[model samples]
Target: MSDTLIDPPADGPTERPLPLRPALEAVLMVADQPLDSVALATAVGHPVEDVVAALQTLAEQYDEQDRGFELRHVAGGWRYYTREAYAPAVEKFVLEGQQARLTQAALETLAVVAYQQPVSRARVSAVRGVNVDGVMRTLLTRGLVEEAGQDVGTGAHLYRTTGYFLERIGVSSLDELPELAPYLPDMEDLEDELERVGGFQTRPDEQPGDQPGAATPTEETP
Candidate 1:
């Protein structure tokens, strides 16, 4: 029998595998959504159990170090979040007396959109108990939220938070959004009120694109 020689394909690029931890970190660092163990494992060519173990280890390491940030599981997946202890410093740096900031109403509307994205304008307005047409337009102009697609049932346009929104918030993904339940009114109650008030009946006549505005940082009301 003769020896067989294997030749590399000339037209294809070579593939290199990275070390498990660094590979996981690199992917998580830029991910705009919470990647599960299976997804991470597939991306890094590692076993799902190994990816899960690595994530747990990383979380523990960060906690032991008292780092300003933390690895957290939220919305059913894992991502990074600023440790509560460092929120003040982080906020000061991010806000920086920026004369322009989101208004309270806009902020509230944005939170609803961020949490319930791929949601229709009607649903958003319903949740907020107010017409969100203008606020949604503002969010779109600022590149914080975007048109996701049309809702199959109503044929209404759906919206979701943008990757830019995650970047601005210094979070890797939506899963990292701080828990709002403790601070805000009960969402179920709010939704019930919205329904009773018939909030979802009305919608913006103009589509998101028809709204006119320049993207600019907002100023807090005095």
Candidate 2:
């Protein structure tokens, strides 16, 4: 064999492309949010018709095969969801895991946020009487809490319990969040605690209980 140095072609392919279905699955697996047809098509470098067909076929195959997870199209987008038939198993697994793992402090912090949503981390910390940054990050990572908005006065990011949190707790709304309030001090004491910590006291009237929307993630990501 002759010794030689080779220069690669600059304009040719860099890597072998994945087939359409595999590519779509790969993208959806990593997606934290639903992807619409146009996005999926652009990603897989396929036509929209082909993408839609592949998605439908995949959905049917999953259904027929009785898979634990499924491909679903909702709110003008497509994503992977736990198969409804398997939700109890998944929920049991998740709730059991959560119960085993979440610490007492985390549970307390979660309760604070649950009862006082759109709440700032500062407020949660003040309520808990300790800095809750790390614990809050854990909650965020576990999908138990999520950024709702920001405090208009201080600009601190506010967070709320996610739909996943509600699902795990077996509640349709915060109104049904039980056992925390009785253990907490009376409203007068709680208001004093808020005032002492320079935090806002979330009003009961603003709890969104009356409107009680399902803590459902079917339409969007938590």
Candidate 1 structure quality by residue, lDDT tens digits, 1-222: 769987779878766767888888777765544667886788788888988999999999999999988888777677778899999997786556343687888788888888777776666665655566667766876778998877775566788999988998899988888887355444344555545545243333223222212221223321
Runs in model 1 deviating more than 4 A are 1-16, 97-222
Give the C-alpha miss distance for residue 194 in model 2, angstroms: 33
> Clash number for every model?
3, 0
Assess candidate 1 and give its lDDT. 0.69
For residues 169-202, what per-residue lDDT tens digits would candidate 2 score against the true structure?
7889878867666665443355555555442343
Q: Alpha carbon lDDT of residue 31, candidate 2?
A: 67
Worst 10 residues of 1 by lDDT: 208-217
What TM-scores do the predictions have?
0.44, 0.47
